[model samples]
Target: MIGLAATPEVSLADEPVRIRAWGLPPQTAITLRAWVRDEKGDIFHSRAFYQTDTEGKVDLEQSEATGGDFRGIYPMGLFWALKPTTPYRRLIKWDVMGSPFLVHLELYPSVLLVPSEDHLPAVTTVVERWYVAPGVQRLQVRDGRVRGALFLPPGEGPFPGVIEMFGGLGGLLEFRSSLLASRGFACLALAYSAYEDLPKFMPTVDLTYFEEAAQFLLRNPKVSGDGVGVVAVCKAAEIALCMASYLPQVQATVCINGTNAVNGNFLTYGNISIEGIPYQIERAQTTHSGAMQLSFTLQDPRKPEYQDCILPIERARGPVLFCVGDKDQNYDSLFFANEALARARKKGKQNVYLRRYPGAGHLLEPPGSPFCPVSQSPFFPLPLMWGGELVPHCTAQETCWREMRDFLHSNLAPGTKSKL
Candidate 1:
C-alpha cells in the first residue's frame, strides 16, 4: 500500500488541494488505499474498502454521492491527503489501470474502533420479509449470515436471480444488485472482504463463497433459476466473469471493469477452451487506452481444468450486457468486454450486449447513489493516466441505465428461472 498522495485535500470538490487542513475538526476521517478507483468516481470516493463510522455519525468526512442511479438515497464520501489548493488531480497511480493500486485516507473524528470479526456486515434480515418488490419477492430458501439491504422487483411466483460480487474491500453497499432486485429480480449485494473477522490485507481466494451465495439466491422461491445473472466491479469483476463461464446457475453476466486473467481457482478467459465459453462475446469499448495498455498477463482469463462449467457464458443460456466507460483509462471496460463478446461470436454464440460510456470512468453506472454526495470528497486521479482530460459528465452513464433495464426485462422475462 505504498505510493501515497504527495499532497492533501483542503476544500470542497473543486480540484485537488495544494495543502491539507492543519487539524482534525468535527469531521470524520478515513484511510484509502485503492488507485484512481472505480464505481462512482468524480464524486463519491467509493472502493468498498473500510469505514469507521461505528457510531453512525456522519462527520465532515462524510460527504454526499452525486447523481447516478437511485436519485439520492445513498450518500458516499472520500478523504484524501492533499495540499491546500494545488488544483487537485484525481491521480491515484502512474502506470496500469488494474494495478495493485493504493491511495490511503485516515478520516478524522475517528468513529468506530473497527470490529475484528471479519464476517459479512453486522446486519441481518429474514429475506422473505425483506422482499425487494411488493409480492414479487419470495423466500423459497435462505441460508448464510449477512448484513445489508436486498433489492427485489415486482412479479409472480418465479423470477430470475442475480448476485453482485465484489472484493472484501468492495463491500456490499447494496447499490447495484438492489436496483436490479427492484425491477422484479432477486439480486443480492454479496460482500466478501472488509468484514469484521477477515485480515486487513488482500489474499488469493476461491469462488466457493460466491458459488454458495449464487446457489442460495437462485434457489430462493423468488428466483426463477433459469438463468442466474451476476455483475461485478473491479477485482470482483474478474471473479464474476469466471463464474459466468463456470457456475451452472449463472444464466447471464454483466461483468464490469474486471480482469480477464485467470486465478488459481476461478476459470479465466485465456484458459477456457471452446468447451467452456464455446464462443466469444463482445463486452464494450472506450477511447480510454490506459486500461487496455494496463496489461492482462496477470489476468489469466481461463477456466479451471474442470470437466464442466456450472453456468457457462457461452451457454449464456440467457444473455449478457457488457458496460464500460470510455474514459475508463483502465482500458475502457467496454472495449475489454467487447473483446470477450467478439470471441463468443466467432464461436457461433450471440447473446452478449456490450455498452461503453464516452467520458465516464469506472463504476460510473452504479444504481441509487446518494445524490450530490461529492462534497468534502477526496479527488483520486489516475495521475499518470489523466492524459490532461477532465472528468466530464458522460452520456454513456444515462444510456447504460436504460440499457440495463431493457436488457434485464427482455432477457430475464417474467416467471422464468433465468433460463433461455
Candidate 2:
C-alpha cells in the first residue's frame, strides 16, 4: 500500500530527483520511488533501485519502468534501473520504482482526483490527415504590413475570435489553429520573428502588433467583433497577457510558460518601436549530462520598474487561464501562475483559472519532441533547460488538453454575458 497525499521534499531537476528513502535495512536491495512527467503526456517516470545495508540504510534503487512515462516504448524494455518503481493511478505514477513490493506517496497539485469520465479519447490514431473542416476559411491578413494566415469558422454571423502565437522557433503551424477554427472560432497563427523574411533573429516584439491583429480579427464578419481572445505559449505568453491589458478587443487570454513582465527591450515591428521593456532577460546554458541552459530577465520581480508587466494581470479586462508545470525548469510556470493570480486577486478580480502539473515542462504542445526542449536542442548549451516529465498513458497530454479545452469553452462561450 502507498501513502496518500504524502508530501515528499524532492525537486525533480536535471538529474533524476532523489528522495530520502526511509526504513531500509543496510546491505539489501530496496526500492527507490518517485513520480514525474512532462506536459505532452507521452513519457512516464521510472524508479531505478540500489541496494541497502544492514544499518538501516537503503541506497536509492532502480526498477523496471512501471509508470505512465514509459508507455511510448514499453513491455519489451523501456529503460529502468534496478531502482524502486512507482504504481499507476489516475494516469499518474509515483514509483515504488517498479519494485514488486511497492508504495506511493505524493503531495498537493500532483494529486488530482481525476474523475473516470476524463479518459484519453478512444481515437488513438495519430493525427495525420489534415482537414479544413466545417467552418474554416483561409484569409491573408496583415498586422502593420507583416502578413500571416487566418482561419475563421463559416456560418457564424458573429462568434468569438482568438489570436494564437507559436514559439519563436516555429512557423505558423496552421494545423492546430485550423482545428480551433473548426470549433467555431476565428483563429489566426501569427509569427513575428525567426522564419523566412520576418526577422533574422528574435527581434523585439510589440504588444501593439498583437493589438492590431486583434483588431483585424474583430473586424472580420465571422468574428463576434465584440472582442477577441488570445492564446500564447513560451515567450509569447507575456505578450498575450499584455494584449488583454492594452487592447480593448481582447477578452480572454491563456498564457503558458511565458515571461510575466516586459523585462526585455521592446521589439520593433515595421518602423514603430514600443519602448519601456526592461532589458533583464538572461538565457540558460545546457550540458551534455542533460542539464539545461537558462535565460531570464535581470529585472527584479519585486521592483516598481517591473510593475508594467505585473500591471496587466491586475488590469486584465477578461478572464485568464494559466497552465503551469511544477518541474518546468524554464519559465517557472507555477511561480508565474501564482504571482499573476495573486496580482489579480489584489485587484479584486476572481476570474483566473490556474492549472498546475507537477512534472510538466515547456514546449509540450503544438509539436512536442524528444529534445530536452526542442528549441534548445540545436544550441550547444541549450537555453532555459526544464524538467517537466511526460507521462505514459498520456496523462499530462490528456489532462492538459481536457483542462484547456474546458477552460476556453466555459469562458469564451458564445452569447455569454460580456459588455463587449
lDDT of 1 by residue, 1-420 (tens): 111222332211212222122232233443221123322243223222223244433222343322212121122223221211222222221121112223233322222334223423222111011113233332322356443334556655475667776532443455355446656567776666564443334344445556777766766676674566777775677677767766666667776655444422334333443332222213212234322222222222334542243223475455666776665543335555766777678767777666655565554443211112011212222222211111232234445666666666566664543322
The stretch of ten residues in a row with the least summed lDDT in candidate 2 is: 120-129
Model 1 weakest 10-residue run by lDDT: 122-131
Candidate 2, residue 319: Cα displacement in angstroms equals 0.6
Q: What is the C-alpha local distance difference test score of each model?
A: 0.43, 0.52
Error of 1 at 105 (Å): 29
For all predicted structures, in order, the TM-scores are: 0.51, 0.62
TM-score of 1: 0.51
What is the per-residue lDDT of model 2 for residues 1-420, given as tens digits with 9 covering 90 to 100?
111122122211111222333343445443322323422233332333334345544222332322332422221111221111221111212121121112232221121224133432211111111224533577766656455678877774566677888655544555446656666667887776654566645556666667777777777776774767788887678778767766677778888776666545474445644454555334454557545545443344667655544545766777888877666666666777788888778878888778776667775452211213323333234334655554521235446655665566566666564321
lDDT of 2 at 25: 42
Which parts of model 2 have CA positions greater than 4 angstroms off?
Answer: 1-135, 154-157, 195-197, 267-283, 295-299, 366-386, 392-394, 414-420
Residue 310, candidate 1: alpha-carbon lDDT? 28
> If candidate 2 were superposed on the true structure by all CA atoms, what would the RMSD be?
13.7
